[model samples]
Target: MLAWYTAVVYAVAGAGVLADAGWWPTAALVAASSGLVLKAVWFDPWLTVGVLLDVGVITAVACSWPASVY
Candidate 1:
């Protein structure tokens, strides 16, 4: 369940970056997604929080700049 949600979040971020997300925002999303994946792969307890935070941040950034997405 959690893994599926995380994967979806990554897809959104990747699509955003691939489309028209700015450099800094793209970098942030990449770094965040990478960290979350690392946590999940390692069975870290923080994985849940990390993924949730990443999703929230990504959603917020997207909502904040609807025009930035092209």
Candidate 2:
């Protein structure tokens, strides 16, 4: 199920973050980016909050990256 997959993705991303793994950013980005489409199909006002949070996470990640990567 899509919801189950979503849950797993979120869990993996969270775990990766907590563990400070080098790959966490990629996993987080995947979860956040996919949340955009998933939120659309399963529209909920609360989901909008999630999308906003995802945007914030993306911004934070981008800001943390070195300008050299740009």
Q: Which of the numbered candidates is closest to the native, going by highest TM-score?
A: 2
Judging by lDDT against the true structure, name the best candidate: 2
Per-structure clash totals for the candidates: 0, 0
Tell how far residue 45 is off in model 2, in angstroms: 3.1
Error of 1 at 19 (Å): 22
What candidate 1 gets wrong by more than 4 Å, as runs, is 1-22, 65-70
Question: Per-residue lDDT of 1-70 in model 2, one digit per residue for the tens?
Answer: 6666666787897787677677767776777777766887889887778889878867767686534333
Pull out the clashing pairs in model 1.
Answer: none
Give the per-residue lDDT of model 1 (tens digit) for 4-69: 665666677666667765554665566566656666677666567876886776676657655655
Runs of candidate 2 exceeding 4 Å displacement: 65-70
Q: Report RMSD for candidate 1.
A: 7.8
Global lDDT scores for all candidate models: 0.64, 0.73
Q: Compute the lDDT for candidate 2.
A: 0.73
